[model samples]
Target: MLKFVKGYMESIEGVATYPMISLLIFFVFFVILFWWVFTATKEHIKEVSELPLKED
Candidate 1:
């Protein structure tokens, strides 16, 4: 099954760049998410964490 899929993918033109582009996008998203998490205020984190226990 894996060999068949690999052969199919290899037959397509420009398929190689798709994996690189997807990896770049995934890396960029995680970097942004990490920056946001690290830079977030303690007060905001506390407020958000308590949201589930608070009444509507």
Candidate 2:
């Protein structure tokens, strides 16, 4: 297990792609958040649409 950890650490140290990995993570998070917001908004619109219309 220690050897595996050491190898993994060495592999991480050899890479200069931290920014790319971080950007990918951020993009994935943003997509999930946007999807959640879209569904919530759609539900709210449907609920509002079903409300009893006030007869002026």
Candidate 3:
């Protein structure tokens, strides 16, 4: 299995550059995704909370 993966990777043209590009793309995607989640969480926190109301 290891040999197969190694052979497959080696067969690709410009194999060295492929990993670098993949890493960069993943990093950018993760950053954007985290930023989006952070903004959404902040918006959620600002909204009202659900709790039982007590009668005076």
Candidate 4:
């Protein structure tokens, strides 16, 4: 099964670059997410975290 799928992928033209582009996109997304989490304010985090327990 694995060999069949690999052969199918290999048959497609310009398929190799797809994996690299997808990896670059995933890496960039996590980098931005980490930056946001680290730079977030402590007070803002506390407020958002307590929202679930607060009454409407």
As for TM-score, the candidate ahead, 1 or 4, is 1
User: What does candidate 2's lDDT look like per residue over 1-56, in tens digits?
Assistant: 99998888778864657879999999999999998877787778777777877454
lDDT of 3 by residue, 1-56 (tens): 99999999999989999789999999999999998877786546555232235334
lDDT of 1 by residue, 1-56 (tens): 99999999999999989999999999999999999999999999999999999998
Clashes of 2: 0
Per-model CA lDDT versus the true structure: 0.99, 0.82, 0.80, 0.99
Q: What TM-score do all the candidates reach, one by one? A: 0.84, 0.45, 0.49, 0.83
Which 10 consecutive residues of model 2 have the lowest summed lDDT? Answer: 47-56
Question: How displaced is residue 6 in candidate 1, in Å?
Answer: 2.8
Looking at candidate 2, what is the lDDT of residue 24?
Answer: 97
After superposing candidate 1 on the true structure, give the runs of residues whose Cα lies further than 4 Å from its correct spot.
none
C-alpha RMSD (angstroms) for model 2:
8.6
Where is model 2 more than 4 Å wrong at Cα? 1-13, 41-56
The C-alpha RMSD in Å for every predicted model, in order, reads 1.3, 8.6, 6.5, 1.2
